[model samples]
Target: MTAQDPNRVFKSGFVTIAGAPNAGKSTLLNRIVGQKVSIISSKPQTTRTRILGVCHRPGAQVVFYDTPGIFAAGDRFNAKIVGTALSAVAEADLLLAVVDAARPDPAAEELLAEKIAGRRLPVVIALNKVDLIAEKGALLAMIERWSDRRGCQAVVPVSALDGTQVEELVAALIAALPEGPPYFPEEALTDATERFIAAELIREKIFRLTGEEVPYASAVTVEAFKVSADGRKVSIAATIHLERDSQKGIVIGKGGAMLKRIGSEARREIEQMTGASVFLKLFVRVQKNWRKDAKAIERFGY
Candidate 1:
């Protein structure tokens, strides 16, 4: 049957977004969800886990999972991040291998082929950040190479930041989706809990404020999330853990200004996400090498 056949039942499936670091995978995912479920930052490997954001339309439910940008495994923490990203690839019913259309890296292409080679899962390539390229021919060449190398079902060029060709990419995802019952409620946008989103939002802000390895070596934990009986407010106590006291100070900023700014930005985003005025209480602590601590890594949801 045709993709738009009225006689066909609604389609549903898990679509995983996978690519190398700074490939715009998270950006594309945020656009697809029409909300910021996955955090994005200028830093590489901003996403550390698989976050499922559901997209329900009139005739389909596309459960999209945004994963950490897949990079070559390095240290303990990075290995876990790569592990989480690869697991999403294996679990997905449809895979969108995202790539940066402006700068096509050969390493990314090699890794994509290595991970997906011989897999039977339906694969589509999304050429993201096409707006960065001045010439359309260059974008076309990149798409052609990826499509030829990967045997993609469709190669959709999109600029996730500018909303260029995003809807077409979503349509491609929907067309590839398989027939199944909706895994989430119609109104449910994400499978993650409020605590998870809050922690991620805080981390995103931290990444924005800090430089160097601060974002990579840091983790946030929500000690308590309590809602007031008034149903209009949420109170949260959270801890931001760093590997060293020096890193802690960096996160806290000079005279507490940086930490205050980070908290304010995170609180605003959390309030929007939770639909409540959030009174976020943030504390910075030294985990004393948490990334290397296996137990601490597990607790951080790595």
Candidate 2:
């Protein structure tokens, strides 16, 4: 059964994108879905929960769930984050194991292997960031290495950032999906709401712009989202929750410059998404070690 079948049955199922931290799982999801349903950053642990995006094709609707990166979940907080990713794994019909071809983390890879071992799920390994590989032999070796490690449906080398061989990867995933009705409407792109996506966009900007403990300690919550008549404009009130007063100072910057910058950047993306003018207001507050506290984690939607 190949992806190019002329008379293929309509297929749809959940394909959970799973891998270690910074392996380009979210990047691949966004690329395949053709939208930024999940956030991405250079920082590890940027994704904290499951983000679902639907890919509509000729004969199949591929529902993709982007999971948080797998890590050494020893501490309680880390354990909770890892638990979220594991739960998504339990819901997968096909596992798209995306691995970074540029940088390898053996410990995290071992952890991922252990968690999915004996699950009997059909796995497809995507060697993302292949465009970064100057040596074609190295990419082939990695593909061979992954193929020998597991009985994957396919081991595809791709550059999720550059859309290299992504179509092949998509066809492989959709081909693996079981025959069924679409989980979401053909026009639907993601399961997340506007409020959630807006907040995520804000957080993504923070991750991209900030340095040190700022991104790790920060979480955004949309306090109020009001849309005007006919939905041409939206007014949003969101808070950037931090772990310390010092961190809040860092985000606020001199004369509220940093906060303004984050808000401006986030608002532009929100406008593009909503196709409406976004009036965004961001406030920074200290939650004081919220990442370590369970209640705070829940409050932050992690």
Model 1 per-residue lDDT tens digits across residues 99-185: 887888888778877887667788888888888888898876777777776447889999999999988888888888877887888
lDDT at position 161, candidate 1: 99
lDDT of 2 by residue, 32-115 (tens): 889889989999989988999999888788988899888878777778888999888888999999899887667777888888
Residue 83 alpha-carbon offset, candidate 2, angstroms: 0.8
Give candidate 2 regions above 4 Å deviation: 1-6
TM-score of model 2 relative to the true fold? 0.96
In order, the Cα lDDT scores of the candidates are 0.87, 0.88
- Inter-residue clash pairs, candidate 1: none
Q: Give all TM-scores, in the order shown.
A: 0.96, 0.96
**Clash pairs of candidate 2?**
none
